[model samples]
Target: MNAQSPKTVDDTRLDSVIYQDGIMRISYTLTKTSKDEIDSDAFTKDKKALAASVSCDEKGLGQFVKSGLLIKYTINDSSSAPITDFQIGKSDCL
Candidate 1:
């Protein structure tokens, strides 16, 4: 039997995002922006910034962020392959 790798998302200026063993964990910071302000347009406009701010890939993470799920108080960790299709959401930084 093979063991799967743990999924993870880094803390942002406003919140922390993590996925471990299929469970998604999202915690907000004191500076966390209001959820009401986080809309599709805002997410779309800030995709790059959001991706950069977090520890996830711009493209993969963009999918979830664009979906407005990131703003939620709770979210389910996707089974999708990390950094592949709708997955972990981590990107390589130079």
Candidate 2:
């Protein structure tokens, strides 16, 4: 599924990058920006800062780099029991 889904709009928030020795760890975060509906025009202006870490080991070392978008949206329906979609873009970084 595309990360641009309505439900994935929150999972693209702040993420964590962990480096262990020559190994690298990565994570992604989804957050709710506001309860208000997002505007198509404003949403198109979304952008995120890509970051990563690598080791200088002589042997093959692990590297971690992430580049993606952070989405924000609200639950417009209270009676729907919350419809959430977790299937978003592939993790091709690993």
Candidate 3:
């Protein structure tokens, strides 16, 4: 008999509508194979970098840069609370 390891997959979801501040937030739930959790400072830094890389020019109205980002990760299946939640953005995004 042969045994195979289970594949790990992470799911990410985005809200249908973007916030008024021109920020789009995405959420991801942690799984058993995922890391314990990340600190606020690290989370903030990473999310900001991610937001900067994303393009917000959906309407073709010039090049719109990503001003901010918010990321939240939930730990464990029992708890509804998030393990880490972070948001970063620019003041003059619009």
**How many clashes (backbone atoms < 3 Å, residues ≥3 apart in a chain or on different chains) does model 1 have?**
6
Taking the tens digit of each residue's C-alpha lDDT, what string does model 1 give over 8-33?
33622223455555445543332324
TM-score of each: 0.24, 0.22, 0.37
Better of 2 and 3 by TM-score: 3
- CA deviation > 4 Å runs, candidate 1: 1-18, 22-24, 29-40, 52-94
Q: What TM-score does prediction 2 earn?
A: 0.22
Candidate 3 per-residue C-alpha lDDT over 55-91 given as tens digits, one digit per residue, 9 for 90 to 100: 3344531143332443222222213345555443343
Candidate 2: tens digits of C-alpha lDDT, residues 1-94: 1243333333453233444543333333335433244453344233211121122122323221223322222222233222231211114233
Q: Candidate 3, 73: how far from true, in Å?
A: 13
CA lDDT for candidate 1: 0.36
**How far does residue 39 in candidate 3 sit from its true spot (Å)?**
1.8
C-alpha RMSD in Å of predicted model 2 compared with the true structure: 12.4
| lDDT winner, 1 or 2 | 1
